[model samples]
Target: METVEFKGSHDPEKKIVVSLFWTVRKTIREEGCAPVHIKRIRTSRNVYEPEGRKLLKLSDDIMEDILRDMEMGNTVEFEMTMGTESLRVLIDDKRFSVEATRTPEIEKEIVEKLEHETSKLTPDFCQTFLPRIFPNQ
Candidate 1:
């Protein structure tokens, strides 16, 4: 597994850590990594740079390799450093409690926050981490 540096997290750490294999959506939402993978991209030719102006182009073989690598699912795991949450509600004397992962509302809110955090990243870090995943291109 390859590790990537993502500078757009809410974490106060000087260097924001990110995982390369995590889904872009999941990574942005849960890990708080910058989703700037291709947000501010303006491409003229085959190769284009992210907002930070670092040029990047995945070779045909490298692209194929990536796709192939992703074919298998559910391989990565994270240690749950943060504990889970429980939400409770009472309606007309009926009581209900929901686990954090069971509620759609909370998940949506998390995604929204992740999008906002991801948008804060500087484009410079975009190209810096990509080459590590697809080298020898």
Candidate 2:
């Protein structure tokens, strides 16, 4: 399977994942595909700057949670899939980690383990969620 990944230094304050998590949340809700649920997380800042890219806040508890997920060997990851394309984001460390991704066959397995569903959406969803990434056809 073809894959694209974004690797970056982890944020100890857990702000990176917070933004990543919200990105997944926004994609899922706006896509309106499979049933996916998310916690009502409080962001340090508004996602939309009104004229800029989305920004989010990282919290202490989120860092703890990421540690726990890694400790359990099941880091909190999300998958977003549309047709043949997909994205998979993983945030399991503060010192260093990766970002989001799309749902693959492992969705069921991950969901069963974390009690979290795979956030999925249609191809059209990308047009809105990531216009820069997937521009209009």
Candidate 3:
């Protein structure tokens, strides 16, 4: 699997994150992927360790809840598996990024779709990442 991280010109609001989430879901579904698992890990200031919940579906409401936790100075991470590929969204006070893995060819398609979709929605929110290095290559 190759990983792609999305960057933006500036920190995006919750709505933008929701848009990005939907874009990714649509792109992966186009490739015939099905939802496998969705997990939300929440960290709190008082808790000794973070708590995590495995959700049946990655709904819009859950995503919004994650954003709310992030706003409250809590760390929330979301991971979802579809087919053989996986998506991980990191949201915190300092950084926000979406990381996904797929075959090289599929990765290209996903990126292109994300670029086109996001451009239509807002200022090209899906930006660059580190050069992808495949071990077999």
Candidate 4:
């Protein structure tokens, strides 16, 4: 079970889990797998049991709820699985992490993808301005 993680604090807007979820959805699509379902959700207040125990697809609405929960100071954690590969997401206030139980190759791919996406979201201010002023001569 390999894992890749991202910290929300690093994000300028602190939307690390949002970016992580997008990456996960993209990875699932790229791997040609059907949409993954939420196996379970554990929140600070209570355990949310999805109707029928497995019908809850992780959608934008669910994400919104999670964000709302976080805003209210409730920690949210959930697990989604695709076959033998499972991804666990833990979000608390401004901190977030993901644990992926997948092949090393897949894990590395997720890390690279997350890094690339995060780079776009949080650009280095110094690097951006320094290059413009110095002009690589």
Better of 1 and 3 by lDDT: 3
Off by over 4 Å in 3: 1-13, 16-23, 26-30, 45-65, 104-137
**Candidate 4 structure quality by residue, lDDT tens digits, 48-128:** 556875465444455556667877866687777765667776665644456676643555565556555554646222223
lDDT of each: 0.30, 0.34, 0.46, 0.53
Better of 3 and 4 by lDDT: 4
Candidate 4 similarity to native, TM-score: 0.55
Q: Which of 2 and 4 is ahead in TM-score?
A: 4
Model 2 TM-score, 2 decimals: 0.26
Compared with the true structure, what per-residue lDDT tens digits does model 3 show for residues 94-137? 44445566544544454555445434535433332101111111
Per-candidate TM-score against the hidden true structure:
0.23, 0.26, 0.43, 0.55
For residues 64-108, could you state the per-residue lDDT of candidate 2 as single tens digits? 554555555443553434333244544444222222244343333
Judging by lDDT against the true structure, name the best candidate: 4
* Residue 93 lDDT, candidate 4, scale 0-100: 61
RMSD of each: 17.3, 13.0, 10.9, 11.3
Give residue 109's lDDT in candidate 1 (0 to 100). Answer: 48
Instruction: Give the total clashing residue pairs for model 3.
Output: 0
lDDT of 2: 0.34
